[model samples]
Target chain A: MQTVQTIITDLKDKPGALLPILHAVQNSLGYVPPEIVPTIAKALNLSRAEVHGVISFYHYFRDHAPGKKTVRICRAESCLAMGGKALESQIKTKLGIDYHETTEDGNYSLEAVYCLGNCACSPAIQIDNDVYGRVTAESFNEILTEQSA
Target chain B: MSITVYVPCDSSAVSLGANRVANAITQEAEKRGVEINVVRNGSRGMYWLEPMVEVATDNGRIAYGAVKTGDVASLFDANFLNGGTHALNLGLTEEIPYLKKQQRLTFARVGITDPVSVEDYVAHDGYRGLKNALSYSQAEIVKHVSDSGLRGRGGAAFPTGIKWNTVLNTPSEQKYIICNADEGDSGTFSDRMIMEGDPLVLIEGMTIAGLAVGATQGYIYLRIEYPHALEILNAAIANATAANYLGENIQGSGKTFHLEVRQGAGAYVCGEETALMESLEGKRGLVRFKPPLPAISGLFGKPTVVNNVISLASVPVILDKGGEFYRDFGMGRSRGTLPLQLAGNLKHAGLVELAFGATLREVLYDFGGGSATGKPIRAVQVGGPLGSYLPESQFDTPLDYEAFAAIWAVLGHGGIVAFDETVDMAQMAKYSMEFCVEESCGKCTPCRIGSTRGYEVMDEIVNKRDLDKNIPLLRSLCDTMLNGSLCAMGGMTPYPVLSALNHFPEDFGIKAA
Candidate 1:
């Protein structure tokens, strides 16, 4: 298996390469493990503090491994005006987990994102890599059930 | 002749099942042995009509919209290829009143042509600006942009030509042109649309900026949220490079320019130029105090021209047509068209590229067809999350920058998110403060600590705990955040909070005292 250090080394030479390296690491390793920060810092020739700061600053970068599936719901004003809060409540009730929590079954992780830029459709959600808009409570449940099944 | 069919590959369209609709149409066409050319065009900005399928007809392109996979077979059966009549048919795409009435200077070819095809882009008069730009000296190019009265469309409303002249005058061996595509603003998708629908225009615009400022290196700072745009832009860049529109020695001008796309780690503050530069340098996204403006000293401590996607995308037309012709549109200081995004609970939520001075009521009613829920529109948040929430009484305000400023509201990024009567203004106000607390970079105290305090005070007011005291306290905190913050993220957050409090006092459980 290619180590996270190898990934960092390949991308380190490029200009403004840290974010891409972190994204690549998370993409390959599922999450950016805390132990690899020093290696990334070394590869990019920066302090571990700087590397860690970048990781913690952005909401998208994850430090820990996610569940089998990730569900990101839009919590911006457009979605909020379109019943996103109620949809969020419904998800919490159904999954028995709050925002940023994974289901006990190891099947799902719920996250609150600011905006997915689908305000025209409103009430947008992304399950894994696929985005869905105009999502309702019934449709949300159906999607989750299908993914679990 | 093979029928030409267009289905948008725009992310918003894809999110609403444009991809599925495309797939269904393709598969069904194959099944029926029908000869058709499926062109993946960018969105027309009329998002309500998406998965808007356009068929090329002699009478002009006929549009069928809100198409689903299930409807594809029926569409094929109804002979939609011949502009067949159907429940979803909306006649000729150009004749659609929502689209016909507005001026689309920046987004002229957005939904009309295939985004990735350089040939298609050029056919629609795409790279004429860069071609025209190569013939002129850097000073002339700067003069043209300056005379056009073009300002940064990314909310600040700074003159684009002045910014270009600063970079042009600054003696830097290595200057940069950075296109800010962070677009963290809610209810705004014009940037994403331009990037996805007509990426070449953005590329061409950036190229023009490179030539105009004598800058050889450019970077487009994109947000991580826009995965689709990232793909389209990368592909378009490679295509433009291969075609010699990008990279060194463009059209044998002996001038060199290289462009790259850098992904931003989901920070709203990164939308600010200084913060964007910091993030681009692979550092923590923190706003730097300005004295050395980005145009004078920016991006690796060199002169840089940082512009929003719309501002940069609007450049090609300004170059192709004379700057004076482009300047002829709109009223006052706000010269040129603004791509207004009609979102939220509007019945016909979409993109409307109109000149300045169109009344907000016309946008909400004529183009948007009012609230989607058929309820009265109690409030509309013009601009993004940080924009002020205007009451129904303020709906007639003109869309000009100065007009909005006169009423203490900003036409930031021209994003209008309407809300029906069911919206709770107090809750919305609290969310603004809470949003500030969550997204604050912690560089300034007024934004970091003040926002949290504001959130707490809002909670007290909303929960009806010491309403009179907390309301006044909230106002004072908003004032501090408004005056003392380092950037707009902190400074403008009070726009939404105070606007909500002042406009909808009843929702906050306050009877004007």
Candidate 2:
């Protein structure tokens, strides 16, 4: 029930307020609602195209609703060296989804990230807020089970 | 007095199950009715033995690492509270060769102090640089950094002091200081470590930059990938502000500086300064042409100073110890310590903060201890995805900036990702192009088009569709991307592709041309 007005009211005065406002909207609503774009543009005095342009540019902001949990798998060099490629393939198979796609049950969404800044522990994956490292196929399932339980 | 047990709260360590181990230790302590004070510290950078639990005994902090949740009860059973013998005991934390040999100048407070505690930070000589800066003139502060020979640790290797000097001399009613914490590089994590471990140091450094350049407002443009770093940095900023070390009239110096953390929507190109500013302006993360550098016409079109986390973090130490003290550590123009992050198929993949003169062989064998898979290390990629893939023959090259440049490689961000013999260099080269295609801001056509073309050519080469024609075509495409591109995204993509071809052409189903 978080409205665009609530997100923009506090942020409109700050310099470069669009990003923070967009982040706030996405954070609360789980996605940047397309209908709210006109409202955001009006509040920030930006054109609808300008607001739409920004939302589409960055990969983090999603226009549509997301699955309950976003699964980001590391696709960077360090992780790739430590079996990240395999892990990526395994996770894709397990979840039955590719990058940017949500599961049919709306329980999971897969993403391909370059690096998680956890290079020391390669083959890292972030399930929502928690990042798991040295993640084998088995450990990945264990994590899901532990979380859902 | 309760016995103190230190557990890492570092994101990397947490990713490796440190949180579980911490919870287990707390529950085990409660079960045993042991009066223990568990302090969550940052990682010591020895990641292979992460979840490195430390106990403060009369001797010193003894280390036990790679600890699991199941190992907690046994640790208590063995009375590890007194630093007793345990199978996982790593003796004194300082005595470990991997950590002991590291001249941890910037990382001195990391893993040792409570991250969010300002008191702990001050006790570990954290704000000494800012305290020292308050006593000197702005010119003196800039001079200290210049004399230290500190370059942009975010891979550009641009002189930090020169950037500050430009901003300092620029006359502007409202100047800004932006810390580029958008660490998008594949094999690097030192910036993340600093932000997560000793965030105050970066805050102190940014404050010093603000003081040096007469900027009243500062913003850390951190990437969205690091949620833990975001939390830690926010907490540290709040804590620092509370201590009067960050806000108006900092430390009663009557000088005002306000700091804020701005999250970047996941765009790799935003790591570029101009794109970063563009992103900061709530626009697309597109690269802008130079001549009016960030110091000249930066964020909000005002005189601004943009610095990397490591370069900014290094400032506090440079100010604390005179420039000469830091300058004397490393060789040539690359003075002071470089916290080299060794990763990917390395047995001891961690942070090794050594001086400039160390060779790649020393880092790979002496520090890294060879491949994690027990295979001979074949190709090592330094810098990030843009860095060249060096062969074993070039391993003897010293880690100095000039030396790396002489070998057609870069010491970019001091991130070394090693690949074993089983790695297909052709695939890696292809991935580099793909990464460029994915990350390109699309401001320039060369990077955008050339990357896709590069991927197509590599696919042809990989599949042996037309090795002879496609190989030369790949070189031509690389040449176009190298010169035609607007920024490093296109310009440096050739490094990995060409280097992979030059060094491991056999993998591409062809001999070196």
Candidate 3:
């Protein structure tokens, strides 16, 4: 666990420190803990509402805990054109959880992204940072297998 | 004291191994005990002969192209440092036909200077706009921008000057300026290129926006996918801040402004203004109702000006050269150059910032050189995936906002994705609705529920089950979604589906005998 001082001291004086601190905390602890809000508020000379408002402003900041493995599917226009919807439905059925919902076994957290800009090979998904393009429903099973293992 | 070597850092150049080529030159120069200044610059956007490098000479910058890491030794032997020519021709970097033909006002410094160097930016007349803007009243600045005929480059052609004017008119204790860099459009990398190639211009543009609107705080909503761009921008912001270009009492003007970058999780809907604002507030990517347009009550319910990266980035030039000078380059209501992103199956996939009146044929044939696969170009999808698929007959169409809208299409983000004859329009059509269903924020009924049903109905048409009923159903569904959705995610969802249904009915089994 990172001390509140470490997080605040690391970014307090910077010009655009809010998002970076939020990203840093999330990277270190998987989520931006509510505990840091007060610390960030004090360190940046902001109110808790101000800090929390900044935290909640961007979509990337997560407050809840994530499952062990993350599965992100590209549902952007190009991906959808290439059978992404069917693939998404198949994945949900296989995982038995809808988007933004964690699996019962804590194995996966599924979410959809707009465009990965990997449209050259349509119907793409990002398993962590690695992009898999032209992916089908059949290829999705292998992703779960890796997570299951 | 300075020995200059150019590193062509354009996206196409990177795709064609310019990074490796640049690295090799760096390492070889180190080995030979040559004191060299390596500057990574933006692409000239003439992509066919990419990996194009430039070396500064007494006469002018000399150009070299199609260079690889392996070609470094020959380049060294050819005495490139002293301006000797190799097989990769050289006359003057400025005189290249493709580059020379372009009336580059917005992209004047692109591919010419080091993106990270403030010295290079200043040498190329950077910050002149900000400097000029500093002397003007906020209202005067906004008036100048309004007169320039600048509109939002993200998608909708909202007048930029009007937006700034609104934020200025709104009597708020706290106002905001946000640069929407969530460039989620496929086949479009102008946002990436501009950030990587000329970051200071964007900074300058944003600063001008901040100054124009009496806002002390600003945020750049950047996408997470652009890690490299984020890094470059963060560095530039830091340098600017240290030099007092950003943050408290900028350049001792007694006026204050602070800017920060907010990295977005990969959400497509977040590109929408309200959704972007919501995401910036750290909620689920959901669209907000308009009327209290972002100009009135945006970004924490303060008077906010949300402009796209290109729109904000174009401000400096509009200020420095005068709005009239910047406005003179484009045709009609579209009064400025657009950073056209030519991508997908095209032979020349790169950034081309040209005037609005340029025809599709000129871009596809004259600039893009047709299909990369060497197959006959069948159709092109201008604007991102949400744009309608225009057949060859529409090739005569010019790429202006009104011109494109007149033809039942939109040049969203100026991304042109070319497809060869091999592409199936039916599958593509199905994918469009399917895409909307997947990315829809579920905030509105038309987008969330209608898109899913539209997909099913589209599938029914292609599968030839109750074909007549389903075709009309899909059309009606598209119509409802278009009118009802809060944002274009649901609104523009109809473009691909409707275009496919209209143009390729045979593919949907209507004419298939």
Q: Best by lDDT, which number?
A: 2
Could you tell me which residue pairs clash in candidate 2? none
Fraction of the reference Cα-Cα interface contacts (below 8 Å) that each candidate reproduces: 0.75, 0.84, 0.19
Model 3 spans > 4 angstroms off:
A3-22, A29-149, B9-16
Chain B TM-score, one value per candidate, order as shown: 0.99, 0.99, 0.96
Return the candidate ranking by lDDT, descending.
Answer: 2, 1, 3
Alpha-carbon error at B143 in model 2, in Å? Answer: 0.8
Interface RMSD computed for candidate 2 is what? Answer: 0.6
> What tens-digit string does per-residue lDDT give for candidate 2 at B1-513?
899999999999998889989999999999989899999898899999998999999999999988999999999999999998999999999999998888989898899999999999999888999999999999999999999998888888899889999999999999999999999988999999888889999999999999999999999999999999999999999999999999999999999999999999999999999999999988889899897888888999999998899999999999999888889998988899999999998999999999889999999998899999999999999999899999999999999999999988999988999999989999999999999989999989999999999988888888988887999999999999999999999999999999999999899898666
What DockQ values do the models have? Answer: 0.79, 0.88, 0.18
| DockQ ranking, best first | 2, 1, 3
Candidate scoring better on lDDT of 1 and 2: 2
- For every model shown, what is its TM-score relative to the native structure? 0.98, 0.99, 0.84
Model 2 sits at a Cα RMSD from the real structure of: 0.9
User: Model 2: how far is B400 from its true place, Å?
Assistant: 0.9
